[model samples]
Target: MALPRVSALRASVRAQLSAQCYHRTFHGSSARTGRNRASVLVAGGAALVAGLIAGASRIQRAEMTGARVPTALDGKDLESRCSCFMAPPVTPLEGLRSPDMKSRMELLIMETQAEVCRALAEVDGGASFIVDRWQREEGGGGISCVLQDGKVFEKAGVNVSVVHGFLSEESIRQMKSRGKSLKTKDGKLPFSAMGVSSVIHPKNPHVPTIHFNYRYFEIEEADGNKQWWFGGGTDLTPTYLNQEDIVHFHQTLKEACDQHSPTFYPKFKKWCDDYFFIKHRGESRGVGGIFFDDLDSPSKEELFKFVQSCAKAVVPCYVPIVEKHKNDSFTPEEKLWQQLRRGRYVEFNLVYDRGTKFGLATPGSRIESILMSLPLTARWEYMYTPPANSKEGEILKVLREPKDWVH
Candidate 1:
């Protein structure tokens, strides 16, 4: 359910009360006394105050019930009956019924989140995810699911967030850097961001950690114009390199992209490589998969289908690797190496990732959801180095120079 729009409620109440007061005024004597007009003014003022109090009471009831009031402006026309979804659709169902891209994206991510979670649970054998459905006061809300200390995964978080609100000046400036000509009124422009993001940390070092996100963004100017874009990527960060596994991962991504355009895989792969680089360490976060942003090109429907393909490609891309290696034996030293790699992951997300920065800067941003990508644990050592001939050293070399995994 959505957060109740008190402003809208107030407007409705005001209109109704104002109509009644005005109707009486119209039907009254044509030559009314000044005293009568003053009385009428006082009555109007009292009506407004009463309307405000009534709106406040409704909002309070909603909060107390942990639900929202179904107003004519909201839930009435919408129809949502999908029980398999992780939560109630963030966008109104009526809006989703149309050819609206926002609603489509919301549905896509919700379905993706459910599918991903169910697949992971199947692999975990018994460990189930804990789901939290939360609403942001500003506009929308999200469903967050986590499975910690599972049989196969150490920690995994699959989250779907749908939020709409005003963008801060800094956020607009960042968007402007992407070549978006954004104009705001009163230093704030309405915007919406919706996405499905997941990070899977397998208990086994050989299994690797996987992260992927697919999102749609819309920013509206004061003149009632809006700009929409789609952005997302799927990437792998392995503690140790498995050539066959990496090949399969990239191949799946390539297949997804290939279905859209030949240029997609190559262009987005390079973008992924560049975006995930750790400048200070002179290494990429992991062997790159594919990353692209500000993708308002080609066509909206085409791009949406492309993102859908990529999102659906996730299960086939990753689950096989986990199934094959979940029980692979490893030494304590190798586990420590995995921890070290996780520390690097933490570094990339916290210090360099734009998503993390924006999430932190946004109002009402969920801290746990924002930082959910971090592994359950990590180790940062001073000037740590593996033996040149070791597998750990080989992995570092791979990170330093990303190979054409699919090729």
Candidate 2:
């Protein structure tokens, strides 16, 4: 089935909100005393204002847009003009072709979050997601949907964010170090980023934990040049070895890739294996699926379609496996093993995961949303070992030595 057109939905929501709201942009400035200050109205709420303040670091010294104002507008006016209550639509990039890539990608991710969460709720049959809507101070916000202690899933979270802001020189340098060629006249880059990220931890040890994220990023340069790229992948982590499940997972991802490019599956599968490797432990994080970054190729339209294809494939690839093993019986010992494995998952995220690091470092990042990928529970047993021939041991072998699941 085709994904929902969230762009239209977004427009509809904006129309509803517009009738009840007016525009007020909070401008931030760094005074001569080197103290950062922002003119903000508290009409919406403290939390909304706080998010904008946290994100205010991106405003440059000279780019302050509005005059300082202390008090919020009186009563009804204050309530009407606050920008904090609603997420502003992303400003469309000028000179771009027919379909606005920024809007298109953002809608796709938002809709995917809704689709995935709905499907997961149906599969869980007992728990529904609680949605948290938050706005970024800079420009935009997101919805974080989470379900905990479900019949099928122990903890699952799917979050979608659309944010645009100026990138500091330090941030640009970091990206350049990672092979991103970003340039700006005033030593700062204006950027827009949007994506859907999810991680699922099933109640049954037989059901593997799965994660997937797809994102689109654009950086505008000083010379009026704009550079854009796409990045994403999915991977599986299981406590017990099941070749059929692993094979099906890889094959499903491969079919998605093949529809876009014959080389995508193989290339990205290897990339996933490399990207998710826990270098210190000398092991792969999971049976790799597909991962690719900095993808700007045939055309924006083509890449957008390719990304949509991959997003659509996620449900089919994972739901069946959850259905097959979610009811399977397991022992306390098996549950313990899963906890230990989750410990490794924690190690990788805290130590080596770029997303975790980036989110932590980002000025306006929501800590709760960023860390939502972590499992509800985890354990570390010093010098623990499983029987050499046990199911847990078998899975460890594949993790230690990554496999070609679809071969």
Question: Could you estimate the TM-score for every candidate?
Answer: 0.80, 0.76
Question: Distance (Å) between predicted and true CA of 99, model 2?
Answer: 3.0
For candidate 2, report its TM-score: 0.76
Which window of 10 residues has the lowest lDDT sum in candidate 1? 57-66
Residues 39-136, candidate 2, lDDT per residue (tens digit)?
22211111122332222211101001112322323323322222232222233222112246775566457546755665676678746565556667
- What is the Å distance of residue 67 in model 1 from its true position? 34
Best by TM-score: 1
lDDT of 1 by residue, 1-407 (tens): 12123334334423432232111111111232431111111111111112112112111111111122222323322322223344456665556665477876786787677667766877888765666566788888887777888899999888999999998777778788878898789899999999999999998888889999999999889898989999999999999988888888888788778877999999999999999999989999999899999899899878988888788778777877787888789999989999999999999999999888888878888898999999999999999999988999998899888788776
* lDDT to native, each model: 0.74, 0.70
